[model samples]
Target: MAALEAEIARRPGHNIKRAEQALMTAKAAVLREFELTVPQYAGMVVLSYLPGTSGAQLARICAVTPQTMATVLSNLEAKGLVTRTPSSVHQKVFVTKLTRAGNALIKRADVKAHAVEDRLVAEFSDDERRLLADLLERAIKVLNG
Candidate 1:
């Protein structure tokens, strides 16, 4: 504990990266069963709720680059999990929607993802959980600024 604290003191934001790596690793392990990467799962979850979302919008929501989102969408399309078409309102914009398979997969995968979230907060009280979430969001806002 002393060594970890010393390291964290020496390198601010190290713990954030460590936490992110740990969370992503655990998430990847569970999502592997569903044949989904974290970004792919994220994109699908958004599409499940907001079908016909433009790719640019999805990229921004997912916090991924447009190129990365494009690849994710392509992979999902190849898997028959999603479809992309020219937007009705904007002919040049490509919108994405989950297919039946994508919807079903996200339903199944969401349970596993929630399990990871539950495990992450298992030791925290509800208030603590909320506080932690709020703190992370605040950090993101500050960093974005």
Candidate 2:
């Protein structure tokens, strides 16, 4: 562990490069199955988390601004993949739902991404996965704060 950490300290670019590679790999796989960019795919994944989740909530979850979420929603809706309705929870708020096509797309993306995700974290145990996720969440908070 110490040796690896020392090496990583000297070659710090590996961290960012690996992250980018993973993103690119996932993007390529998704593109093969659906016509969505990385950000659009991210929005779709966020939408899948809760079918009726508000766009503003999704924007926060996906670390994007509301306007970017709106654009992504526009593209997804145009493709007949999602539906937006005036929220009963709030008069002016719109809740987004994945349409049949959107559900199907998310499922397909899951299958396509499995290999890449597995490769990325194959070394982690269940506990390690949890810790890694927690640490990354913390880092995101620190960086974005």
Candidate 3:
């Protein structure tokens, strides 16, 4: 029990988790003003960048299951933020794009979302930021391996 406690205290992953929670909480609060959840915001961002992307592709890019992305897309559609058209090539697939309102909302929300990331790295120098990113990638690779 003592060893486990000591290991937990020494682990940096806990700090990473705490930081993630803080970042998400801050973004969620700001996004709520625009009637967006984190996943919805993510979907809008991807759609804005890659218009006509299929839901399955968006699901892969957003790292959510197809079912979850479908729910998010449904909600966005209901809000008139996006439109999904049946694909010409694939009957089962639908291509998604932002409505004008969605584009505008995503643009507005992007400012707020980026602010959170800006605030997160506000204290770091350019070199330090790059180093931190590299270190995180290395850590992720090691863990995944």
Candidate 4:
């Protein structure tokens, strides 16, 4: 245990990755109740927020490859949670939108997800939460660059 703690203290990236993995695990467990995977739930959430989004755009937003997004979109479609219609501007492009059922499912899932998030940051003040978000975003931007 001390060794693990020492390693974590020495590597911020490793610590962040471990935290992310733990969060994903907890989220997966919550999503399981709705028969959804983490990727599926993320796709649904994005679709709910941005109706008529393209699969490619969704892939970027979800930080998954286009091929992976295709699979996730397929699963969501099979579950009747989303629909894809050919874009009016581009016949070759397909636009995705959540169905009423998808919207409902995401709403419930959001509640559960928020509960998990709240618990994770329960000790932090509002300012601390905002600061953490800003710092994470800056790190992501640097890494992406």
Best prediction by lDDT: 3
lDDT of 2: 0.81
* Candidate 3, residue 64: how far the Cα is off, in Å: 1.7
Instruction: Give lDDT tens digits, candidate 4, residues 1-145.
Output: 9998897779979879988999999999999999999999999999988999999999999999999999999999999999999999998899999999999999999899878888989979999999999999999899899
Q: For model 4, what is the error of residue 76's alpha carbon versus the real structure, in angstroms, after optimal superposition?
A: 0.7
**lDDT winner between candidates 2 and 4:** 4
User: Could you give me the TM-score of model 4 versus the true structure?
Assistant: 0.90
Candidate 3 per-residue lDDT, tens place, 31-132, comes to 999999999999999999999999999999998999999999999999999999999999999989999999999999999999999998998999999999
Which candidate would rank higher by TM-score, 1 or 2? 1
- What's the lDDT for all of these models? 0.92, 0.81, 0.95, 0.93
Summed backbone clashes in each candidate are: 0, 0, 0, 0
Give per-model CA RMSD.
2.3, 4.8, 2.0, 2.0
TM-score of each: 0.90, 0.73, 0.90, 0.90
| Worst-scoring 10-residue span by lDDT in model 2 | 25-34
Clashing pairs in 4: none
Against the true structure, candidate 1 reaches a TM-score of: 0.90
Q: In model 1, where is the ten-residue run with the lowest total lDDT?
A: 7-16
